[model samples]
Target: MADWISRDDRLPVPVTAYGPLHLLARHVHRLSDTGQAHEAITAADAYLVIARIVRDEKSVRFLIQGKMYALLALGRVNEAYPLAIALLHSQRAAGSVLGEAKALCDLARIHLLGGHYVDCMRNLARAGVLLGTAPAETDRHRSALCSFATAATAAELYEAAAGAYEQLRHSTSSFDLVHAVTLLYWGLRLAHVGRSEEARSRLRRSAEITRAWLETDPDPTITAMHALALAKLGETTVAEKLARSVIMELRAGGSHQYARMAHLALGISLRAHGFPQEARREFIAARDLTEEGSRPDERPIIRFELALTALDLDSGQASRDLFETVEGQVRELWRLRLQRLAMLRQARQREETEAARARAEREILRDPLTGLGNRRRFDLLIGAVSPAREAPLTLLLIDLDHFKAVNDIHSHSVGDLALREVAAILRAHCRQGDEAVRYAGDEFVIFLGGDAEAGSEVGERIRMAVAEADILTDLHMTVSVGVATWSSGMTGEQLFQAADSRLYAAKWSGRNTTAA
Candidate 1:
């Protein structure tokens, strides 16, 4: 397990002075740093008790922020809502624009997890306005934007959500556990929005990237996110182990909020695996953490899910009441969802039409004969290739061996057939994100996006494929491939020249070979 998501990219959050809020934060950080969820929650609760008795608005807000942060870190969606809603009102009363926006965003998060799309968007819109009106750029703007993105995902506004998350996942502070937990929600929302595979990819990537930090110390939220992703992707054994491990870690840590969320995640995974009884027990454990007045909306959330599970198990009165209470609301929201989706789809029609037209225009850069992108297309690609932290792009210059001789003996028609066949082979080998181009007659260039290490493997695969296939029966063909990876200082011309030099080296060494 790699310990770094890159040394500089994901360092540990710096420890702060241990005020009650800061102390709670330090313990709260343990959810990711040490998996001490139980302790964190207990500490927060103790703090809240003192703050409520003292009842100073400033102190109350401070304590509430600390506790709310703990709850959110633990992924306690239901438990967090009532406090979040109250915080929103309190912040508005304080006339702290940034705090109010942050509060609105937090409330949106609560609604989002509850599947309250309308409420989520409503809060997001109001938050966005407050965020915009803020005199200067602040963390509240960023937080509000994240909530907007989450709402977009919950609303199944995929295009917007996709774009929003693409920016957010890159922009958020990776070292912060709260930000890391948001990644879980980002992934869940992605899955709910019908981008399941995308969600799996993202979550697993998060796991792989965070494995280093997690290996050094256990983090319930990251571990849980990883487990959930793996389970969704059908890696049941490993995922189950990871998910079950969270309970032990949470209990050991003794953080109420983190324990609640961990159980909730485990319960969802269990439900997916057809363990309704096990799932119910996990959900109940999560719900038991709630105080009567903490989240009145909590029952409907759990009950709705309980009713579904009860259908397969022995559902009780609570499940029936929840279903009866929430069923109409769920239906109405779903109805609104369909309407929203229809309008979104309609709005996209013109956008799609414009895209199609642009695509047609771009096709002018495609080679008419082989259907691979032509030199013109390659030029555009080269121009777009800023030497940022993109994948190390490999340029493979593939030239047909003894091509002039083939035309001399077999006729240009046969030569054309060979070129077309080679193009077809390139097309077959490349996927959606890979780029293949006809650089010139008898010469092709392929840009293996981020697959630089696979240069030899890809070349070998293509060479063997060409060797095995007969474009014109009994007329065997081979290609000499030259590969060069782009370096930070290299220009497009330099990259092309390096690959070209390798091509010549291949030609000189052997008629049918690859040189890198």
Candidate 2:
């Protein structure tokens, strides 16, 4: 066993079996960090054996989760899923909310890498809820770290994540520096979404905090992230200098992943600042490093960057070849991603269908008697069709005159019948492109897609049709209509306001009228 451990380059085991299991996990982590994934897997298997023999549940669970994490990190997520599920169940059964949350977050990260955004969001939301209820300080820190990881994968969640990190930054003791680096990650994402000023402020604080921590003990990842933020801020010269220093350290230490990413950043920054030749060299170096490290997934990004550089260099054939290669890889990736998405969507549809079948779902704004849209739906329809300047649209507001007399003279059921008949008349006469909505108890709104005159013609046609329809023998309903057309300077709200004002004017002038 000692010889096996020595051959594996793992730490010497103490007399206690659990000690060896712990050391083996650490050894596997180190191997993985250095890009020796095959060796890491071998060591991880050995650790599992020791963990089983030790019969310590905590050590065994920790080793198993670590092994699964390493597997996911190496892009073997299919193999990691069963292990992750088992870990999650075990943690939950033990009331280890923090552990369960962390496991969920890790699973989410794997899904994110595979482009399963919905699944990723589901797991992240669960983890966030559990983290909110976690009791201990250590658990809170762990949860915060997981939250940061999930947020980093999905850029849309950057603002919420930044707030979470800010809260955790003040409370956490362990991995304080790592937390600072995580904040920088969120800051970069915020910057990508056009929040440049906010991003710059957060990044500046993160760099200051990280630099202070690194003064005592250097972290290559923090240095690389800082360089990336500087690049985003357009400080290309300073960013390039920092990135080069990280690259040298990574190359010397045999950390190919960090070196590859750093070089890619340097290449992009150089290109942005008009150093095409140096940028090409850096991109090629990044590509070579990733290829040498045998990371196929990382290669596509580097190849895409190389193709872009070739396009700039005026090498059309070379650029085309690189683009074709990237296109093929992207198609394959998208195929797998779509297959996973279809599975998730099918599952969600089944759940929704079952739930929808269990009850008569009520539409909040529906006419209870006629099964037509009510006033609320009408307002929503009007709000939904607010026009852009590029497309001219028209609105028609119609109100039934003396509607109260129908309810007062006839039974409520007869009044309801008359209203339903008038709604049908409006619906039948409106063109296919026009939307008719019940605006109030006895009023309707129509949105049309034609010029002003056409809209007025359609309104008249609806009025004539309603006049011809016979619902109740003694009831006659005449609709007062107002037409409003959208112009380049109008917004949706303004259009509605203008149309509504005209509608009231028409009603006041005469009981049955159409005014533009």
Candidate 3:
């Protein structure tokens, strides 16, 4: 097992039965960082095998992350995409907020690779929300911040990318390798924003840090980054020579991934020194190499550089052709962006439509005057009650005594108030798994959970509560209730009819009474 991972990207690999698997996972990451993508994938697969045998879900996610990074580095974005999503879901299932945030960042990187800037920004925003409370000093937070910066840069949000890098630079308050890498991204952000002097300063610092590290371990990716820093600083002669040397070494070692970066570095240097023709050739070579193995988004960037170089070339036809090609690609990218926006708008519309429909349904089922379930709601509740599946059902049918006289002697408004008061009393008597409805003008129904005895008790309590209420005191309003319990063979309609007959008995036997 490697003692540590680059001293900058180290993670704790616990000494346990799965220690070998962890070691393998770290090796996979190291291989990917060194541009040995194929070897990294193979190592990741071996790690996955051991993790599966141990049934370690966390280990599995780590392996998936490593393999996915390797695949992405190899420009196998379609293959990496599913793995990115899987990592997100797995972390969510594990209920690790930090892990889920990291997974979101990984998914954002995949979106960046495909030039899906809108989607990339959305994922980065979500990750930021998740990491809002995470400690800044942790490796997970630093990793997520790095991803945010990279994605923001891809989306052309240079200010936001620079802000993230600034946070990363201040996280440890030390001049370490992590800070060095952050400086490089910070420099890239500055370059995009046209602050060339500031960009050169940051790049130089990052290059110096990496140069010191390279003396101990000759990492080609680090070497390429140093060349890029030199190129960006406008050290044209030395930058061009170093870039060429790095490209030759990487290509000879079959590390075309870093070779592409070296080519870009050389192009940048040549362009800065007024060698447009040489710059154009280097840019074209980089673009071709990117098409072979780099991320889909990288080729267009190289083409953009190529177009810029072509603007100063002697051949007008070549210049127009290059400009046209870049314009067409940009137009297609914009079209895709618009299509995604339209789909999102349509999805939001569908959700709003569904919500409006649900609100309308609720309004229809509710009584406007009493805020209680209406007749339609009563019917639906009764239809759901079955003797075969539940305990004996109880129905309480209630009516206001001399309710018409109250409406006639008093105002209709007073009668409405009295009805609302009765509904309140019925609701107070309702228990869990019970339904209360305003069945008609003055009649109410409640489906109770138990036998007729329980129904009669609730019905009596509602009767007394209504008789004593101060509402429309002069009208002396009181409610009579009828209680009916269903037998195993009785239907909902038969039970309702029985309750109605009992209601009639209560009216005849004295008002303000319960008849069971």
Candidate 4:
């Protein structure tokens, strides 16, 4: 070993220093994987100094970020946050978009592990947008990072991450090992969201990849993930065996995180296999190890799991004590959320109140019964516009073809429902910037934001939706629509008049079509 080390001077310095960091990261990851978090954190600190001295800033940043992730994984979130935030800020300042995205992704993962779902979502969204702007060369790393972040948040968000990973997978145009791991992450996320069959399929593919790799170079993390996949697939015996192997490897190598995760997997497998006593012991050990190095918030989940296990063990007092602690923490979290909600509600109310006041002021210029812009408001708007600023605008006038018959055939209740249904159809079909109003008892008007062709399309769509509405299942209902565009010298009133005349022509021609 000494002779080989001396002979490999070219491979020694950078490889040796970085090799330990890699090993430490893998160890921390395994400890996290196995639920031996106490041991993982103790081993993780040794990599910090060497990681800082790496010549490549990007690689070093990722190394430190991975350490922070491990810290969080071990439930050491408070310890992770300051360093994570500083690294993220530094990456952002350096204009390393991909690095910044990765940092944010890590921070989000910490929040997620701590069960801060909302914060996790916010950070994931930010990271996603930044990662979108990242160059293609970094796509694989970003995709994996984002997938992890998304999976940690909520199962529903995993689809987005999966889509990103798919894009990366296709762009890379290779059957990379990381792609298989990503598929496994996506599978677990799918299971969380109740897509069991699809999850199983993906997990099987992931297992195949890991198995192939393990044939040549066995990695404990890969084995651990395979165990999780097997467990998810309901292969309890196989999962347990794999988990045991992973644990042995971790113990042999003094790898904390893998051991912790392996313990967690073993506990799950035991519980599934009806070994309650053994399962409880493993769960307790896993929980204790996780809590040993984790943040206060992170500890709650571990505590919660432990409490549940205690309940299952019929230890009433222990369970009750754990519940009380959980309750207090939950209440604090609720209070903070409520405060934020209250502040948002107050701000929204203020804005709405101001909007209501403005609407009230404007109401004076609208027709009372029809809620349409009164002639005065139209006159004011048209008069205020200079000829130089005038652009093409279309107006549409609509009329219920047999509204009087509707009121006569149906009671006023049905008649009102019919009118409201038509109004809703109009509202739904209209463009966002367009305006629709009840012009009178049987007439409606629309102010279009664009040219005659666009207005004609809007008029047609509204007519179709109204015709299709099931408001009067017994009666066949339809409307006459007319569209007219303002020419170079036309006034707004002239436009309305032309549209109205065309509407009458439409009623005369067919009583159920648009006239353009």
Candidate 5:
């Protein structure tokens, strides 16, 4: 902590005797945003102490949120949880829907950092629902929702994110940095789901807006996002220059995480421009910069991009595995298979004993707890079902909403039974061609031959079936579903990601809803 928290360095002193409180508070905010969490915490705490002493609820609200945010950034979850609960209580007591929304968003953010995606989405959904039902949503409420939506996007809930950004874009009169960031996210999400042309258009608009806004508001984040968007829009040279500038600025500021992101963005631009080796180098640096304390949601995308760049690094096994992920491109895949066929030898094959052992090993793919296939089996199925080759393949990624809370409140035994019941419902409703897999604890996936509409119908049926099941004595299960059908230009991984994003959208729309 900094000396800003000394007894003599109180907010009252700053406001009345020492310096301007507004300037001090702004400085505190800048500290928090620029990754100086410990310093920000001290300043925020000092302000909070003075605000409470003076009974300034408004100042208290702002200062407390800043304090919690700093605590969150520092990975001090155990401390942040109780404070979050207290904030929610105070917000409700004050009859401020906006404040309550902020509290919920903070809790959701904590859950997100803890890798409790289901819990995060549930809290986020509740907050959105609460603010949405309010009789009058002023600019403040809209702004709060926009922030919530930004969190949703971070959680990979694209539909809710787009809706939130759209609302904020239309509602807010000011075209500032936040607006620029929102448009960038909206465009990025659009690209994630295979709307490349429209996404490019949006990205171009985002870049234009950001370029103009940069004259007054210079931020590395805006610069990085604009560069990535330009890369996506095929202006790789321009994107590289912009991303490099961002990396330089971020590195100078000690913003390692953003610097890492900038590295990855530049790698993407380099790769698009046919510089795979350069891209691999950039990706390597990006991966090296990641710390254990970095946000959980960022890890997956970072690793995914790193693997994509690894292909050009002459990495054999990993590259082969990654190449299989290029689903739906039949001719190329067949060519690769043919290239490997010459290496196969049948006469030196295993005997019946070895064949039986192999079969037994494959049989272990079923999840023992829920009687569904495990993640390995899910991966195998996705590998076989190419999205680019067959547009009919649909993926439905499902998450049991608030399952962690159930485990915490009831018992793990009850949670297991609830999972079993949910699995049974899924098994009962899945069509003949569908395969249900328990991807992870409280998370499941379904791969089927169907269109998006059929996938949605099946997802809804699964939801209804689980809601109707009562095998667990004290447990109830509700699931959120994200559906994605294979489309041209989409890889298997991208298809799965699309479904995952929809799952969050479902969770955001009040869990148990299906988003396709």
Candidate 6:
């Protein structure tokens, strides 16, 4: 263990100060994203030390979450569980329901690994209740939902798990590792329900996605799952070979938790190849690995498989006892399944209601024609700005040149198209924290963090872009832009008036130009 920890000398140095916490956190996330779990842990540990010293609760929570992810990635579920419990307590003390929900989901992940299906479902149910009022699109919400789906799979809520995975799959990019894992787990669920063909397709797609970027050094955990998928698909020879290699890698890397699954994969393939005796050994080995405080969530499945092999070996009474034990476990799982179903129904209703409310709110704050923020959103932004501004803020006011003429000549439809195009251009130019708004007909506003000089440069680019737009080629469309930097103690109205004056000047000087 010490050797493995010391091997990653190339890990990024932890941030020395609180200000660089964001950078350090990003570094940890990037390493995690690239499947560098050991490096991620080292980086996160460094960040965690600084975060604790600064007493920055947010940073501490984030660092803990990052470390938990890295530990789970390395199949160190035992190490992650206490962190998750601590996080849950912290979140509860902070009075943050959403954060608490996410923490519970993290706990569910631990329970899922340990073959604690009832506990997993119980945690997920509690998380669902906490998330009742949270925004559906938030990262915390999405991550919690993913945990729910995984737990649902283990708890035998096949339909619910499938639906949740499908929803998440549609929302995530194909290149995302989360998306690949979602597909992989969804495939495993499908296989559990005897949808072998669909399971194979999903597993294949997941493998392809991982292979796309992970060609150099693939994740052993995913490779092990892929091997299991292959075994389920009856590719016994290839599956056996791949599973053996994955088991060796996982064990050597000290990822004994995932190594158990690798053993299960090997067992499956060996059984498929008619070596029931050898397969039983692999199954028992997998079960034995659950000792020493390891999560035994997988033991149920392993025991079931061992019982099958026992029957094949003509150990009738031993197999029967194993089956009876498994049946008792199944009965408990079924009870949890019923509770989970009720929770899922209630959660789904809440989500749908909240989604509806959110949609209505967005529609109110958004411009229908341009798809930009409406005047209402502009008001909200301006109202939030303090008189003693902390940073330079520049506003750009723009008006389409001769937009009325375009409507008169080409009809109102063409005018609308031009507006949408301009809106898209504005959206493209604005930075992540900037705002672009459709103020009114033929008028738009951009709020950015910079001085007048920077604002003028952006205004000039927008003016040029609008003038050269191919969609407006025949119409000869152009725009006049005015840039105004907010002065200390200036009200939103004063800022607007200043930009308006500059915009009038740009129009007077000749349209399609910028004035600062």
* Model 5 Cα lDDT, one tens digit per residue, 191-221: 5445678777777777787777667777787
lDDT (10s digit) by residue, model 1, range 270-297: 8778898988897787777654222333
Total backbone clashes of candidate 2, pairs 3 or more residues apart or in separate chains: 0
Cα distance off (Å), candidate 1, residue 504: 1.9
How many backbone clashes does every candidate have?
Answer: 8, 0, 0, 16, 2, 3
Q: Between candidates 2 and 5, which one is better according to TM-score?
A: 5
User: Per-model C-alpha lDDT, please?
Assistant: 0.68, 0.70, 0.76, 0.66, 0.72, 0.77
Model 6: which ten-residue window has the lowest total lDDT?
11-20
Determine which window of 10 residues in candidate 2 has minimal summed lDDT. 150-159
Residue-level lDDT tens digits of model 4 in 1-516: 688878875644455323444665666667755767666556655555565676444445545655675676555778898878888887876666677767777777677667676666566666655555457655545454545444432323434544555665565634345556556655754554456898888888877877777787678976776776677678879889988887777756865545655676676688788776787787676565663453233344344445555666675786778766765665565455445434434543554566567778789777664445655665665464343446557788889888888899897778877777777777676674566777677777777778989988988988887787798669667999999987876766677788988998998898889999
What would you estimate as the lDDT of candidate 2? 0.70
- Backbone clashes in model 3, listed as residue pairs: none
Off by over 4 Å in 4: 1-123, 138-206, 292-516
Of the pair 3 and 5, which is ahead by lDDT?
A: 3
**What residue pairs are clashing in model 2?**
none
What are the clashing pairs of model 5? 328-388, 328-389
Question: Which parts of model 6 are misplaced by more than 4 Å?
Answer: 1-40, 43-67, 73-287, 292-296, 300-330, 388-391
For model 6, residues 94-118, the per-residue Cα lDDT tens digits are 7677788778777877887787755
Candidate 6 has what TM-score? 0.55
Question: Each model's TM-score?
Answer: 0.37, 0.48, 0.48, 0.39, 0.50, 0.55
Ranking by lDDT: 6, 3, 5, 2, 1, 4
lDDT of 3 by residue, 1-516 (tens): 254666557567555633346666777889998889999999888878888898877678878888998998877999999999999998887667778888887897788778776676567666766666577777777877777666655554444555676687676533355445556655754564456888888888888887887788677766776777777777667767778777877878876656776887899888888888888788877776764565444565566667767776755887788777776775575455455545434543554566568779989999999988999999998887675756768999999998898888888999999888888888888876687899999999998988877888888888888878988546567888899998887778888999999999998998788999
| Model 6 steric clash pairs | 114-296, 114-297, 115-297
Error of 1 at 174 (Å): 43
